[model samples]
Structure formats: C-alpha cells, structure tokens
Target chain A: MVIQDLKVLICDDSMFARKKMNMTISALGINEVFEAADGEEAVAKYKENKPDVVFMDIIMPRITGIEALKQIIEFDPDAKVVMASSVGTQGHLKEALRAGAADFLQKPISDEDTRAILENAAKGVL
Target chain B: MFAQFFGGYLLHKKLVTSEDLTQAFEDKKHTRMRLGVLAINAGLMTADQVEHVNITQQSVDKRFGDLAVELGYVTEEQVDKLLSQQPTEYLLLGQTLVNNGVLSNAQFEQAINDYKTDNELTDSDLEGSKNESLNKLVTEFYHLEEASNARMLTDYVTMMFKNIIRFIDGDFTPLEAIVIREFDAETLIEQRITGTYDAVTCITAEKDVYFEFAKRFAGENFGDITGFENETVGEFLNVVNGLFAVNQSNEGGAELTMTPQQFIQDKKISFEKPAFCIPVVFSFGEVDFIVSTE
Candidate 1:
C-alpha cells in the first residue's frame, strides 16, 4: 500500500499549527486526513477512525501529547504515532516514544519531515 | 518572523543564551525589529533614548516617525523619506548586512526597490511595525474575514503578548483554553467591584490548565494590578472578541460587540448591556495574558 493512500490524524490545539499540518499533509499528497483540536479529540478520533498513523502534538489541553500517545499505545501497541512539538520538549518527546510514538517531528513542521515521518510510519503498518 | 529575525541577531551577538533567546524569540520571533532597537543598534541613538521613546510611544498615540521627530533624533524629512519605502530602516539593515557579506548595499537596494514595485505599495501605505508572529498568530488563529478587525486583533494580541510573555519568561508553548459556559452577569459585576476578579474569572476557566495559567499569572501580578481578572479577562476577551468580530465580518457583520467594562459595583451594572460574556479560556501556562482595549 502506498503511504499517500493511508489515513493520518493531525492533532494540535493551535488552529494555525493544525491548519499547517493539514496543509502539509495535503501537500505531501495524502488524501485521507483527519484533525483534532486537542489530545482528547485526538483520542476520540483515533478510537473512531484508527488512522494508519497519528501525528500528536505535545503540550495540549485535557491530554498532553505524551499522555494521549500512551492512551493510544494502550489501545494498540503497534499503533504508528508521530509526536509533533516545538523545540525543548525533549523529555516529553522521549516519554512519547517510550509510550509508543513511532517518531518525532519538530516544529515548525516542514514538507520533508512530514513526508519522511508519514512514509516511515506507514512502512510499519501497510 | 520577528522571533527568527531577532533570535538570529541576539544569537549572532551571543548576548543571550540559546535557550533564553529561543524562548523570547519563539513568542515574538517575527516581531518586526523595533525602530528603537534598530536605531540604537545602528549607533544612531543611545539605549536610554530608545527606552524613553518607546515609553512615550506607549503613553501617546504617536507614531515612530512622530516620536523620533519630536525628540529631535531625526528630522521630519529623514523619517518622511524612510517612510516612503518598505521596511527600509537603512541604518539598521545596512549595518546588520554590511559586516556580513550575505548581500551588498546595491543588492539590498535592488531588493527593496523590487519589493516595493512588485507589491504595488505606495508611500502612503505604512506597514505596521508589529512582531509578525503575534500578527500572524491572531489573524490565523481567528481566520477572520474582516481585514481591519483582524489587524486590530493582531495589534491587541501583539501588545498583550509583549507584556504577558514576561511572566513565563516568554513561552509560546500552545495550550487549550477550556472556557466554562457558566457565569451570572450580576454576580460577576458584584465580584468585580469587591476585587474578586481573579476568582470570578477562575469560575470561567474551571479546567486544570486554565487554572494553572490563572494562578501563575495572578499569583505574581494580581496585587500589583487591581481589577486584575477583569483586566486579564478583558485581554482574553479581546482575543475571543477579535476572533469573533473577524470571523463574523464575513457573514455581513454578526453585530457581536462587547459592553463589559470595569464596573464600580451595584447600580444594576447596566442590565441593558450585552449579557453574554465569554470566558476565553487559555490552556497554556506559559503564554500569560495582559489587558488590552481596542
């Protein structure tokens, strides 16, 4: 299965950041894109849709990225999740990966990084 | 933009640690190089003079050009000439790029000329000297249709961010603002008069993170600032208001305007005023907020 054909979830509380993720994902040639306002939203969407990969943001309301990632992990240990955050979120990022984040993409998210993370994560599933 | 631009400058000079620079730069990275900083760094004026000018600008509705001219630092002719161009603070840009051979004077001049001609901005169009990130954040966050309202919102947020970022030492880390839906307008006004603004505003956030930001911001600056939450909430209201105003403008003006103000308590607090006051809950503890009126 091609990575571009897979479903992806972009979770961030920031409208700007969320839109950017949506745009970047769309620009990356991905068709089925999902979005959530925060960690709780991410979890609800994840449970509902179970996208191929989840792009989670650290430092969100209701659920921090790490906690959300852990919750997602608990649901599916093999869930391919990528953590998105600004610089200086090292411990959280580390904890996220430990909690089963497949990869981490630092903000401001760029085209190459999104492509690589999604493609790489997709390799594990599809 | 100001964050990146200013961060690069501070980092290049080793004036601030990479961490602090990053922290400050992140919140306001795109804030346009302040004219005062630009002038001072360019060796055109002293730091003290810049500080005084900034204070004066804040106190009055004076433009940089007006202030600079009033202070005799620059003549009306000099400012008028510079105003004719695009972000063309020659002394600052020239000095910044001169020592570094990234672009020559002629090339810079050509780029400026091209930038102006291609954009079709005449001398009359004075681009705001605000931090681009704050401007961008407000506009993008709201996604408003009213350009003027959006610009006002951007300016309001830019001012609020400038003051609030100081609380957490400048953290732009995003957070969710869980604004609670319950508030009795009369009780809120009564509390406002009695100096329970923080607690009153607290009832609105209700969420964990909103409480954290409120506690942290209020704990530090509450006593120092009377009518604290009313002012703080006003700032938050401005964010939400701007967002609402801008978004509603697209649908031919939704007629959403705020009537809440610093009440002196009692006397009905004007029952005729707009009843619905939204608690614009902020989820981030890092990004503190300040009061704004505009």
Candidate 2:
C-alpha cells in the first residue's frame, strides 16, 4: 500500500498526544485515522477497524498498551502494533516484544520518527 | 539546567532581584557574550585584566580580543577557543545582566567564582548536561540529601529539571523546596508511581499561570479550551514520571509504573509522608511540583 492509502489507529490516554499524532498521520495523506483514549477503546477499535498500523501507548487506564497489544494479536496474529511509550525501559521493551509488538518508539517521539514508521508500514516492512 | 540553577543561586544570594532576573531572561536572547566575560569565566584573565583591556580599547582602535592578546593576558589561540565556543545559557544570562547594569563586571566575576566553588562545579560541568554534575547541583540546591530517599529524590528532581528544560520553558528559576504534608491547591494534577516503590507527584498552579504553562506544551490552539489545561499539564507530569521510571529501571533495576493522572481543583490533599514542594518561577508565574516517596 502507498502511504496515502494506509489507515492508522492511535491509542493514547493523553488528548495532547493523540491530537499531535493524529495531525501527523493525517498530514502524511492518510485519510483514515482512528484514535482511542484508553486501552479498552484501543482493543475495541482494533477489532472493529483493523487498521494498517496501530500506535499504542503503554500506560493507559482500563488496560495497558501491552495487554491491548496481546488482545489484538490474539484476534489477528499478524497485527502491526507499534508500542509508543515514554517508558522504553529494558523490561517494557522485552515485555512488549514478547507480547508481539511490531516495534517500539520512545517519547517524546519526533515528527520524523512518526513519518519513518508510516513509510515502513506502507512498504510492508514494519 | 545549570543556567536555571545558577539563576536560582544568584537570587538566593540576593545578588540580583527577581525583577532583574526576569528582565535578563527576556533580554538574554539578543545578548552577545563579550570576550572579557568569556575570558574571565575561563580563568585566563582576571576582572582587573578585563578592565584594563576595556580601558585600552577605548584609547586604541584595536578589538578587545586583539588588545588582550597584545597585553599578554590571553594567547591568540585561547582567544579563538573562547570566541569559537557557543555561549552557554548561564553565561548569556550573566552577560545580559552586566549589559543592563544590574551587575557590575566585578560582581559578575565574584558571583561566578563563588558559585562554582560553592557547588564544587568545574567550568566543564557548567557548560554541559552531565548527569553527575546535575545530580550534585539538585541535591545541594534543594538539600535533597536530608531526605530519607536522597538518591531517589536526587534522581527524580534532576530528571524533572531536565524535562522542564526539554518540554517546558527553560527560562524558569527553581526556588527552594519546602517539606509539606498537606497543601491546599488551586488546581493540581496528581500521579502516583507504584511497583518496587510507591511515590506521589503533583503539579499545581493558579488558573492563568496553569493555562500559560499548558500553552507552552500544548501550543496555542488548545489553550482556551475548557478543562484542557489540566490535561496538558497532567500529560507533562506523566511524561516526566515515565522517563524517571524508565531511568530507574535501566540504571537500578527498579520496575515502576504510574497510575492515570488525577486532577483535583480547590481541594485539600495530604500526603502520608512528607513531600518536597519545589516552587519554580517562570515568566508567567509560580508553579509548584510536589514529590513524596511513600
């Protein structure tokens, strides 16, 4: 899929974070973008839409990004979920990867980082 | 980080008033670092030598750096090194204060020397963002060593200042911290860190000041929205705590997690343990950060 054809879902409890990333993803010419304020909504959105890529924040209410990632993977084993978190500790990194995250990005994530991830997703490389 | 703390020290010493600092911070962006101040900061020339160079330059058409070299005060190579180095923020602040006559050159020299000697900081430490130097500055400035969790407190406060510089405004003066068990907050965002240890962190400020602080992080579009200021400030605290937790995990193998931030307005909250309430004054107003290790 080309970058313009990609659909993205952003899951973050912070309205500021979600709004910032949503603007970034939309700016990349991807018309379809989804947002969730918490992990429960993230899982529900994932199962409902199955976007091309998911940007998941680790610390959230209701459930964590890791738990949400596991649930999404159980529903679709080939899900492209990138764990975007401020806490990129070795423990969280190992746990996220073990739970089948496609990749991890540390915060505060830059615009270039988001663009690069979307490019990789479009190329089927994530 | 060093610049903010150095300003705090100057305020604590009463060398400069808060109004003087606020003005200097505003003007420092356009202030150029003079060669004499740079030389004095480098220890290559004393304040008297710098005065002599300034007086000599008034008579001769030669530049200050050239005259200093001709007078054997500093070598041409040293002058080049001093000029080539990008001026640090604290030095810019000092230069601005001097330009505005808030501080004399001699007073600036004495203040810089005493600041370094008192903090046991070297010139390199002041120029760079080294962790050890910063930890020492935070611990000594806040008297965090007296706390029960000195190491943890030092690490947390150091991380807090770094993020304040990173995400928020760097033009803030970190005031002295007070020990508090309870605080009546106008508007406060609270987040609890739990796991191997438990601690509470909070950010509180008045409505206008809180809105301005949030605007710095969330940009202008989200500024006037009702209830968004609390979310923006809460996210700032959340990001800082997340990074602190990650640092603790990486360096000390302490796994930590933070609960969703809670916003409380016009309420009284008390901590089970004493917390350090650090009041930092920005261009807008004062904001207090409270951290309690429970």
Candidate 3:
C-alpha cells in the first residue's frame, strides 16, 4: 500500500482539530479522508468507511474516543485507532492500550507526527 | 515566559502603558541588542554612562564596548562578558522600549531592577527559566498566596501561561488578576476537573476578541466555517485543562479527569467560590481566563 492510497478517519469534536488534520493529511497526498465530530459519529463512520487508520481525540460530547475505540475494535478486531489526545496520563495511556489502540499520541500533534503515523500505516506497522 | 511576565510587571507598575507594550513587542523583532542595553541590564554600567558612550560614539569610530572600557564605565572583562551574552527576550523588549522612547534608559534600569527584586528573581532565574522561579513569579503576580488552594492555583496559572506561549503567541501581556464571583460573559467555554479535588476553569472574551483568539489557535481564517470560533476556543480550554489534569495525576498522586467543555454565549455564570479572572492582552485583544478551585 502506498501513502496516497490510505483512507484516514479523524474523530474530534473540534472542527478546528479536524480541519487542521485534514489539511495536513491531504497535503501528504492522501485523498480519502473522513471526519466525525463525536464518538457516536466516529463509530458509525468507522463501520461505514472502514478507514485504514483513525485519529481519535479522547474527550467528546456524546461518547468518548476510548469508548468509540472499543466499539470499533469490537466491530472489526483489526481496526487501527490511534488515541490522539491532550490527556496522555498514565491512566489514559494504560486504558487506551488496554482497549487495543494501535498507537497513542499526545495533543498538539505536529504535521511531522502525522506523516510518520501515515508512513507506518502504509508499511503495515502502525 | 520571563519576557511576558516582565511586560506584566511593567504594566502593573505604570512604567509603561499597554500601548507602549504592544508597540514594543511588535518592534522588538527588528531591534538588535546593543552592548549598552546589556551592560545596563547587567548592572555593570549606569544609564548615564551608556548615554555618555552613545554621545561619545557619535564623534569617535570606537565601538560602544571599547569606549565604555576606555571611559572607566565598565572594565574590559565586563565589556567582553556583556557582549558575549545572548540577548534574552525580556532584554530585547526593554531595548525596543528604550529605542522607541516609551521608556527612558533610567526608567528601564529602575523597572528591570525592581521587577527582579520584587519577584526575588536572580540573574540565573531570568536567563534559565527555572520552574521554581516561574512558580514564584506566578504566585506573586496573582497574589495567589492568600487565596485558598494557593499552590494549585499557582501551578495551574503557571502552566496556563506556558501553554499560551507554547501554542499561541508569546507576545502577550498578562494583566493583574481579579477575584470575581459572577461574570456576564459575551463568549465563554468552561470545563471542570474532578477527582481528589474539584476545580472549574473557563476562558471568556468579547465576541471580536473571541474570534481573534480562536483564529490564533486554529491558525486559519474561520470566516467560512460556521460555529468554528466557539469550537476553537473550547478546544484551547480543553487542551489546557487536560494538561493540568495530567500534571496533577503524575506529580501529586492525584487522579483527575476533565468534563467535556461547555460553550456559552451572552450568559451570566457564577462561581461557587471567588474565581481569579486573569485577563491577558494579546496583540489582537484581551481574553479573560477564570479558574476556581472548589
């Protein structure tokens, strides 16, 4: 799989976060991108799109990213949902990994970090 | 960070108006640090001595450092040491103010000295940005030592400024904080930290200033996106509160979690306790950050 062929879903309540990440991923030459404003939409979108990778924020209005991650993994055990959040405390980190998150990134994610994640996903390593 | 607090100090002392600060912050980017300003900041030369050197340099081709040494104002070693040092942000701001004539060299000397002495900041403290010194500065600036949960308030405000500098612009002046029980907010986002202790944090601003702040954080013109201004501001509050929670959990053995942020517009919100409303003036406008530890 090449980087441009990857399908990515971004789940964040903030339109700012989603739009910023979308621009960066699009700049990476990946055209297939999906967005969700909360965890409910995230799970629905994940099941509908079955994106190659998901960037999920921990806090959202309806359901949290962690709960949505669990639902996605339950729907498809191989779902790649990375916890991209502000709170990367020990408890959140341990719980995210326990819920089978592929990776965890602290908030204020740089464009470089996004690129690295996509590269890993393309190589089947994320 | 010291630069920002120094700006705040200047504002508090009435040594410089907010307009002076705004202009100086803008002008500092192009202002080069001269040996005269550095020597005065280092206390090795008086403002009059630096003025004399400036006058003498107009007639002679000698550099400021050589003339200062030759005039017995500063020794050769002191001149070399001052010139060898890198210019910190605060020094650059001071130099800009001096150049702009907003502050006389004497006023700059007095303000810098008093700022250091009042905060009990050593030269190393100003240069190195040690956390202990920052905590002291925050506590002193807000008069948090007399407030309930002083330590927690100090820690939170200190971290807030750090994040503001990290994510937003560093060219902001933090106004003196005031304790308030109620506020009629034009635009506001509130989040709660709960667990071993409870606290509420909020950011509020006028509509235009709110949009400007959201624009700064989002790094885009939000004109096309409907409801983007509120969401961007809410996310900033979320990020700051989340980091504060993580810090508490890791260092203090206090497990904390944040409630989803709530956005309110043109509403009256009252805190159960007296919240410290810290108004920070950016080049764009003033935004108030309110925190109450319950």
Best by lDDT: 2
Which candidate model has the greater TM-score, 1 or 3?
Answer: 3
lDDT (CA) per prediction: 0.49, 0.92, 0.91
In angstroms, give how far residue B47 of model 2 lies from its true place.
2.2
Question: Tens digits of per-residue lDDT for model 2 on B128-217?
Answer: 989999999999999888889999999999999999988887889999999999999999999999888999999999988988899898
What lDDT tens digits, residue by residue, belong to model 2 across residues A1-126?
899999899999988888888888888889999999999999999988989999999989899999999999999999999999988878889999999999999888889999999999999999
Docking class of 1: incorrect
Candidate 1 off by > 4 Å = B1-294
How far residue B191's Cα lies from its native spot in candidate 1, in Å, is 25
- Which pairs in model 2 have colliding backbones? none
Q: Which docking class does model 2 fall in?
A: medium
How do the residues A1-126 of candidate 1 rate in per-residue lDDT, one tens digit apiece? 677888999987655456556877897778999999778889889999989988887656676777888888898887888877642233444576677777777554567888877777667641
Local accuracy of candidate 3 as per-residue lDDT tens digits, B1-294 = 999999999988898899999998999899999888898889888889899999999999998888988999988988778778889999999999999998888898899999999999988899987778999999988889999799899989999999998888998999999899999998999999888789999999999998888888887776578898888988888888888878888898777778888899889999998899999999989999999989
Better of 2 and 3 by TM-score: 3
The better candidate by DockQ, 1 or 3, is: 3
Candidate 2, residue B37: Cα displacement in angstroms equals 1.0
